[model samples]
Target: MPSSAGPSIDTITEGGRVTQVGEGQEAEESVPPVMTFGAPTAGEILAERYELVEHINNDSAGRLVWRGVDVVLRRPVAVVLRYPGGDSATEMLQAAVAASRVIHPNLVGVYDAIDEAERAYVVREWVDGQSLREMVADGPLDPGRATAIGNAAASALAAVHATGMVHGNMHPGTVMISQEGRVVLADARTDGADSRENDVRAVGGILYFALTGHWPHAEAPLRGATAGHGRAAIPDGVRDASGAIAAPRQVRAGVPAYLDDLTMDLLDAGIAPPPSDVLAAELGRLDIPIEEEPYPEPAGPLRFAAETGDEPSPLASVGGRKVAIGIAGLLAVALVGLLIGISALGGDDDPLQTEPVARPSSSAPASGAAPAAATRKLSVSDVRIIDPDSKLRDELGGAERVTDGDQDKGWDTDTYTQPNFGNRKSGMGVWIDLGEEHTVKSVQVSLSATGASAQLFAGKTDPPSTSAGDKLLFTSYRTNPVGQPFEEHDGTTMTFNGFDADAKYRFLLFWLTALPSNDRGYQVGVLEITVQGS
Candidate 1:
């Protein structure tokens, strides 16, 4: 997923069952269209043709794909790139064809762009299953299905911010979970459209990580702008217009205080809450009332070999790639970084430095070469498992490593303490297991706590009996509003199409209100959890 500007907007992931990052199709293409992560993977089949079917990753900015389609549009279409460097493939094919003429369904469908392959892609609809950050589990959802999946993905971000445009990076792995129970939203990279306060903190962190697994907005206390913000609290050019909201049950408790006050007026209102009518009114509040608890069958996948370490820091791998999220548009360009890489992502310029760099120290560096290390390869011994328990072995820290699969490393309670919902002051949670059944796609957590930070959950069980609109697991969280903890949180590894390969689970949640006055609290550790081998 390149686009650090040496390229336009790279992103595209394949095999986890299709990801996007290839867009820029419109410089009169006969056929040059092909790019995956360096930003621009597919679209403009020019006239029906597709093959590539392999290589599932790249990151000098773009590449990470799979291909195989030939005709009546049978299948294989996930591509999203815009990597032609410093704009122009006609301005990234005019922001992916003005986000494919604002079609809205959680947003993701640009279809073409390739001024002779400088690049641009946007033709997604792949999703097989798994993502909400791999299935979320530190707990949170069912506040009427997290406001019916956050007001149907902010009603497809108010129909792409009402055409003035501005999804500018929402989260929850860009949102997608299809096997049937659809909920899409894909990578919609934007360079402009007034950034609608960064799409209202990416739709209020996509409904606060779909009912709280994590993500509450933090470019580190607004990084440098006091009068303007981008990730979670509307403040730029301004305009929820006046919808006004702020109640997710004061912040979580089995949710439903009128869906936490209509998802806080669909995120501090100003108007916006229609995503397919809030996905049919939070999926019709997915039939509630369940205090019993009894739904098991999760335990899958386990092997272990992981050495695949990487990520010197392109902000430690720009969240995961793809950047146009929604109903299933699925995005991942909101690690929103540049502490020093500068401007390419707001650091303001400097960009990685080049040639096997060095000196950074802790964002990551057991070895070296960082700067989005060409696209983080996943760590923590490649974390073979972290959901409902499926077992895979390696070094694990910060505790809580259960396994209902059998009797290997069964333990629980490494940490969990969500007493308040103030979005800060204190928070903790932990769980991990993946021994047998496997189909999970992604999950990565690493925040030590400048104040505090971390959220990645995937559970069908392990303290999560069900609810959040049952079917097992589905939740997400993102925070770091100041609580630093080495800082390294990403999203959308929460997907589900297969689980209980033996039992899988993993939770590492934390948030410590602005601590010591406005200092907040957030501490993190447990450097890796990279998984993907099919």
Candidate 2:
């Protein structure tokens, strides 16, 4: 049987079984081996579907990790195998089932969990990337990259937490950054000991490790770091004499103050961390544009008003002296009011001086000048999915839902092998047509995930509702873009507010240049399309 060194073992029992027992360690009782036969050979198919190709390594809990392929789907997968499955592998299978229910772009997709009585296995999405631990093996990551990674991890946790489940396993090893720059979280554990709060705090640990290349010892024990182990793969955080881990800014130069504050607050036991979704939003706001600016403009410290249900006044903490000064200023204005009152008594005699007031004109405005119109939501008369590349046109079915005003349900692209549709096509889009030409003030597109590259376009003519027409429309829109393209937008909601308000537009194309990475592959959901104009 092939065996590899697992996460550092605390004690080897009489039967040579590794048992980890202590605070923060998952409780597992040592049991006799179930498999008396030889280990699985390369290319051996499990469940007659998954064929193991290569062995990756043994995980911290001594489970076998292998690179495999799903024969039916012809897609790569990761297979985890454990011996004596029935009772011992319950937690692993349960976690896999729970994680499979919550799908997010930043989470590893759980495909199948099976127990064959003698052994158990789980098949999941195979990520062609290195773990955060490997990425920072040489040194720390830059602030922008670190922030982006943190935002992705937090976003994934928010999705998991939304389903009322906890990602018990969170650390550097589980945070995978793909070659395509997609950050995803993997390897969830279902131990009853972990909490959602811990999961939220783990994001801080991720940021600290990315920024400083050191894991905070005060945090939950890392996967491989066990008691009595000579040393862990990642180094412990630098601590002061008071035994407190140093903040990222203290450990490294060039760390932003706001980021430093956020990281420390999450790690601080005294300060409660915000909910996962709120934390994700804050991080997304701070994740500066890599091409535009190296550092984001100073965003003040995060205030968790949402969690506390307290909307503090902007001037709640005004000093007494400042308040007194404001009162004096008001009193001075009151005295001036008194003088005005006295002047009003002699108004007829003094012929009170006043500026002329402009009155409304009953006649029409001058020629060629139009009155400014108030913006209102424009009704979309027709909408359709425009996919020129695929002959099947299978992804075009749910186009109407995008303009249905229901964000929960909408149209989505079929999962592609790559972010750019695997080079199969240039792009895909949703073609929207207003009943007639109207001034387009703004177009807001709500997407299901972030990191998609898209652009909005307006054209005079509407093409045929066929694949051939789609090709022509796509070519025209690509050549003539209406507003600025959102390249790798950090948020799911994108507002193209640069439309020419004076220009009349009847046909508009919401084109997606690139799709965000989902657990299955590259895909995106257009939740809703809202157009506001006169």
Whose TM-score is greatest here?
2
Instruction: State model 2's lDDT.
Output: 0.61
Clashes of each: 179, 0
lDDT of 2 by residue, 162-251 (tens): 777666556675566766787766544433345676777788888988999988743333333444221144688888785667777778
Q: lDDT tens string, model 1, 1-534?
A: 222121112222234433332211111223232343343234434224443344333322322333435346566644433344344344444444445555544443334333345443333344455445444433555444454455455556555555564554445544555555445554444445234434543554555556665544332232222231122233212112342222343344555323333333333222222233333333343324333342211111111111123212121112211110112111222212211010011111211111111001121323664222111121221122223221222223324332111222422222323322233323333334444434333332322222333334344333343222211232343321111232221221121121222333333232222211122322233332333322
Model 1 regions lying over 4 Å from their true place:
1-89, 92-112, 115-123, 126-144, 147-179, 187-189, 195-534
Candidate 1: residue 355 lDDT (0-100): 13
lDDT of 1 at 261: 33
How many clashes would you count in candidate 1? 179
Q: How many residue pairs in model 2 have overlapping backbones?
A: 0
What TM-score should be assigned to candidate 2?
0.50
Q: Which window of ten consecutive residues has the lowest lDDT sum in model 1? A: 351-360
